[model samples]
Target: MDADKMSDLHEEGKNAINAPMLPIGTDIHPEDTLLEENAERIMLDPTSRENLKFKDLLKVLIDWINSELEEERIIVKDLEEDCYDGQVLQKLFEKLSGRKLNVAEVTQSEIGQKQKLQTVLEAVNELLRPHGWTIEWSVDSIHSKNLVAIVYLLVALAMHFQAPIRLPEHVSVQVVVVKKREGILQTALVTKELTSTTEMMLGRFERDAFDTLLDHAPDKLNVVKTSLITFVNKHLNKLNLEVTELESQFADGVYLVLLMGLLEDYFVPLYNFFLTPENFEQKVHNVAFAFELMQDGGLKKPKARPEDVVNLNLKSTLRVLYNLFTNYKNSE
Candidate 1:
């Protein structure tokens, strides 16, 4: 063969030997292709392979790249698994349903009252059933020649609490709605106040402390607010409380406290905290005070045996705190 043809054949041989198991997509850079091709050619040549030094060097490079790719795959698999998990699926369902159910905020022109309400209810029902929550809906009233409607939802909260032996009480959720003349709807949700344990733990904190933690929180305000409100709504009926302005503040406080605790327990030990020592203490104090407030209010008081509290893993609040802190530290 001519020189040029021989060179082309040699290149193709190298490409076949060094090509990744996965084909390169159209988006791959031309420069990367050239570099990879050159490296592969040098590694695959018969004379180069016989040279002990070159073979060892090529082996090391190949191993490093394979290791990195494997690690990335593992991480992606873990995240996918988490998204599929029941708890994660439920949270996503809540967020989507909550948005759809905001009757006052959603315009009739966008989605008719009935359609929006139906969608929200369906989403909630779908999620709840898998998590052992049975949902029941009832029409409260019909008005304007039955063109307008009102409905109520009762959700049975049956998730296993910290101790498998002692299950959480079944709670009821009530949602009220009034259809307007223009086919728009106004809605309100009511649930019982939190349990005595929750109230004691959450009520002890001064509102300002809760606000401070929220102000410094790492996540977006909307995200934090939504999560807090959802959590409160979930347990409100069990607690036997009406939703009020103070309840909003209390929910915010609970979220802030939980986020702070999460930060201390999970992220503080990470090497990243060393870079932000000054902020760490302030964050920790805010979390601890929040916990103290809850403890004082009798919200977080342990009902089971003293040791059960530790075993119960009632540290969800703490987990939130840690996630917030870690997210901020990582961002910095």
Candidate 2:
């Protein structure tokens, strides 16, 4: 564990776990005499503290899920027990009264999982309330943008450079995320990294940048839209997920993990374009470079040593991307 506190001493300030505790002198000490209304003061690393809280919340949720699964097993057992000699019992009940006893039955439901998650999210929000960060859960707001943004990015930069107008069928149904916020949005690069946003001024910057790009590529903008439609359709065919494009049906952490992993796998450079304004043009060039290197077969050989895809083999990169997304889907 990282040191939560430091004290100037001859030896050292031990971590929070090993902090000095008063010696036990009595069966019931003053500290344990009654409920102490006063809050305890302690040092903490902000990043570690947040991470622990997130883990704690998630652990509780996982435990609850396990309990639910156990309850499901119990339900199945009860069903079996109740149905043991079911025909004999049915006859007995039928003979006992004109109206037969109504059998109590229960079946497992996915709704329980959704309710558990909602309750868990609320608990997480409560835990975060003390902190400045406000947790926000949106269904498909950012999820829809995962791969579709690639086409927009390609179109945005295509005005000045040659970007592939046609991507493979696999590009059609990219893994979409169920975007949530533990804090607030910045450049959207580091999700939930910014906790002190009083307003969405940065969001305006995002809009302006997108508007500027679209304005610059007025003629190709509509073509880009058409291309995005085709791309999304192809992506749907590519992925095995049952969810639709705009549906926020899946509100799960798997989506978040997969989305982050996909961005890391597919093209980190493309994501970096929105992160740095000063280096935006170069980043765009770098993004366009990889797509340019890609051909009908897969990622093509680099044109020159300076090429972005020069050192990276196209086939390996695509395989890793496909495999990672596939694994995430299978995990679900």
Candidate 3:
């Protein structure tokens, strides 16, 4: 091979070697993670702990939100419990899910509807505060079809994109959209087969706000939004990074590290819940739901090759993510 190709190979080998395998079920803490050491990276805390138990911690917190939603639903007329349609919200609760919260905000305001909002904000802020994250939510009247609640993730702690190729600053993911129309209130979480599938094979539609957070990714040109495939391809082109190369970089790379860190942190409280047989059964249920839809003429039979599996894996990952909170039987 040419010298240039050889040089590329060497670098790839180095990244592969240096990539960190962050353990699952680790909490995000300022002292526990690279958030302290590297002002430049939104780093991972690699310390492992034993004897962690879930005991339905996630189910409880989720129940709180679900109860709130159930109460509100009687009142957003536009909001429907459509499993395959409606807008997909960002992974706020997932990233925030399964954590311990201080209920101090529960007492902040005793006034009517404001009290419920305060309860959620206080509960979330308390949990995130220690990790250098300040959570904020607002009532959005014009951003969507209904009056919505928008959650903003502010970086209070020193965090960076994953190392090896770290982003200069951390990206704040906007999450947890609550919509109310007429008198009814509902959560917008599900992605659909028709509108949500952006590319025939790439990614799904998250919000354009996510693009603004990434430095190298383009400023979404038109106010008009596009599909996930379009978004991923456009950003990937600008960054000049192939999905395979980025995938191989894994937890060490900037985007994947931050993304995975958030995911793992989100899973901390639900650790045991995942180990439960019900989780897999739910996944299988989700798969069967998906398979039933595939009976349509749109999807072709996939070639059952290892490479094909890889491609399918990428899409499936994105698809699952799109469905993560929205399709959860509990979060409903």
Candidate 4:
């Protein structure tokens, strides 16, 4: 072959190979490069970068959510290990999510159990402060557990009172017993049988007189009993003799004086005598004389009225008296 022809063939072969092989950084044409550069510049601009940052933030948030789900799995495992049953776990989950559980949809047993557990926990917290006691309450059923807890607390308080603390006279402590019914709470200082009478008698007395009555020490049982007896008898006698006449005749001051006199003279000493029941009548007469003399000596005037002398409920009155007497006997 001629040299020029051979060289031409070689050049053709080289062109064929080189045509398929692109140079580094020259695969794109100049116009295409310019278009790409424009596209890149648009994408790299401030607004575009901000959009990219937002997209990245959203991805990060998604990842964080996934992580939280994983963490919840671990927490659930721990809860299971801790013996948190399904109902309790569900409640805890709802609480963590800031949502309310569909209690109505839940089984009655589960709802009851949860409520009972909550009540027991509250009771424990309440008793912990004053009694310095710790309780570990666990239950297969919440209602029974809670009822037991309430009974336990009452019994504990009763036991605490058996060895009563000597509180100062000025710092009076009123012992109010509480009972719960249908999720509602009720309180009474004494039994239900005595409640009406106690309330009636307490209401009839002035606030100061009522407070004075409450302040009497436990040592004055006889005085309290006698006073109550006399007060009841006086009202009964007055009611029986001339109910209509006395109702119209007595003034408020006269009623107050009569009540106060009965309390101070008959009640106070009677309470003292009752504390030592062996000398009950002697103490009653002696205190009655002192009371009369004090009134006659101008220390106190008759302040109660006939109108103030209302008829007492005999049944309620006797019931309260019985309670007082029973309490006295129990103390001895």
Candidate 5:
């Protein structure tokens, strides 16, 4: 083969490996020809627990955006795909801030889209700066349709605006970033938070105390269990039931449901749940039902999953009970 032809083939091989996976019709960088080098990435284990929680946060954010932009007839189903152009983001900023943004409503060229993103993000940062907060996203990240960075920006915006969304507090996701830095392939697994703030600081304090009790202070843990047992029995005594082991007694979720009913002064209908759960699925059903009841009573939704409670996960069970205890400790 001719020298120039051989060189062209070698470059094609290199570009194929480095090309980013972008949606069709999306414009690439101006300097790039067939592909953008060092733009390829792989998100490891998309179905992991942490990733599932991250997906939940994404859904909540999308729902919040759709609700806010309902008047504009803009429904955002995919944050990465829809918001990358900056049209939806511009409208969202205008809606939340109650101020008009001087940006184009539609931009086909990449430069115009990026300019719109720059303007919107700068305005957002201005509003967030007064509260000692700044967005962790950039125009490049948003334009690249980075889901994690987009989520962080939306969460900060929601918190600053008090958008009335039920954000999942204290949730983090493991992200695998693979990039070529200085001609070397580097892979890093990073755990990033999906949301945060003063509320999270308090939650972290509570979690750290629980860890300290669990790790360095068995006696203190036992005292907490005993106090919780006393609290449980105070309400369960009406049905001639008692809790001896905080972990095992709450495993099946029967006592948990009864305790919530007695604590909140509401009767859970027998038809709504199995009075005597005979199988694991039924136990999970009972626990899941109990959480719905908790929400209905205007209590904070527990971060613990129903299956975790059914399996007697100590940390998950403790988190649910502790949330209930803190809220009703002074009530009845």
Candidate 6:
């Protein structure tokens, strides 16, 4: 009977191999996932600093995010449900990093929310990477409303941005991570720390050479910008794009994104971004997305904030262009 079942399975596989191809644009829905939920059972003592760590840090992070996004009127009551849709995160990042993200303001669908989460998290990781901070959460974990993971990310962001909130030093929380698989269930006790500001040792580096040159030497700055402009136009001409006003032109992030694709020999998907930004928010979002792409291509993350470039800040814009120029000056 086992041999007969094997033969039947082989025939079914053969039939599947010979099945007709589906037409383009067909909607292929995927099966539901196993709901990857890692439940965290907090073991708090309420008296010990280690025990009070999670509660103290959670309140600090929530307050910091609320204050940062007060103008947007986004109050993050719980990191789980409030952040699952990505709107709050997007706004928080814009306020922290001073850059708007090119994601939907409101995503109702699971896939849409996940996509936005991926973008926001990638940008967050890029910002944190230069500081030697490691990312502790994934899109799935955050989307699934894992409280522990959410708290970890918020703590990291708060510390990285130096949010004006009082977080206890050496805060640790004992938690049991519960997982079930293949009809088996298991739990592991983990001690997680709400890392303090001192533990990070994130020191700010000196301003970029371009920024310094523009400050002390205006004539030389013009010469350098002109040289970079010529280099930019040489390639941009291929796509009929020009950079007559480097400060104002690249502020929108459209030209910068296109220029990066041209020099790096990659395609910036149109659907992935807005081609014609309608407002200041969209412009900043485009610039931020460009910066992410630059980091993805192994380029050093620029020090300039996305909003700075969008606002036509000469030092910030020059810093970004100068970095690209130094890297791809000799490239075809």
Best by TM-score: 5
Model 4: per-residue Cα lDDT over 76-116, one tens digit each: 22221222223443433343345554443334575564664
Identify the runs in model 5 with alpha carbons over 4 angstroms from their true place: 1-136, 147-208, 276-285, 330-332
C-alpha lDDT of candidate 3 relative to the true structure: 0.28
* Tens digit per residue, CA lDDT, model 2, 67-96: 333524422222112223222223222332
How well does candidate 6 match the true structure in TM-score terms? Answer: 0.46
Candidate 4 residue spans exceeding 4 A from truth: 1-112, 133-136, 139-221, 241-332
Taking all chains together, the TM-score of candidate 1 against the true structure is: 0.22
Score residue 320 of candidate 6 by CA lDDT: 86
The sequence of per-residue lDDT tens digits that candidate 6 reaches over residues 19-57 is: 344333322222111224443323222233235556677
Better of 1 and 6 by lDDT: 6
Per-prediction TM-score to the true structure, in the order listed: 0.22, 0.15, 0.21, 0.22, 0.53, 0.46
Q: Give the best candidate by lDDT.
A: 5
- Rank ordering of all candidates by TM-score, starting from the highest: 5, 6, 4, 1, 3, 2
Writing each residue's lDDT as its tens digit, candidate 1 over 1-332 gives 89999987886676555433322121222332443211311011223224453333333323322332353332222221232212222333343344333334333342344444444446666655675443433111111111111111211221112211122222222222222222222222223221224323233433233344454754554465455444443434343533333222332233344333343343222332222224434444443445554454344422222222223232333343333433444421
Model 3 TM-score? 0.21
- Residues 1-332 of candidate 3: C-alpha lDDT, one tens digit per residue: 99999987886576445444333543334332222222221221222111121112222223333433463342222221210011111122222253433333222232422433344445555655665543433321112222112312211111111101111122222122223332222222221111112121112222323334332444542221234333333334443643433222221223322222233233222332221224334433333333223323233322111221223343333332233222222321
Model 3, residue 1: distance off in Å is 89
Alpha carbon lDDT at 241, candidate 3: 44
> After aligning candidate 4 to the native by TM-score, how far in Å is the CA of 107 from where it should be?
4.7
Tens digits of per-residue lDDT, candidate 5, 1-332, equal: 99999987886676566644433333334322322357545343343334666777788899889978999999999888998988998999899889999998889999999999999999998887777765678898889887777877888787666654457666777655566543434445667766654356334324445656776887888788877778778789988998888778888888888888898898888888878899999998899789888988898666666777888878678778887887888876
Worst lDDT 10-window in candidate 6: 26-35
Candidate 4 weakest lDDT stretch, 10 residues: 163-172
Question: Model 5: what TM-score?
Answer: 0.53
| Cα-based lDDT at residue 311, candidate 1 | 30
> Could you tell me how far off, in angstroms, the CA of residue 234 lies in candidate 6 after the best superposition?
58
How does model 4 score by TM-score?
0.22
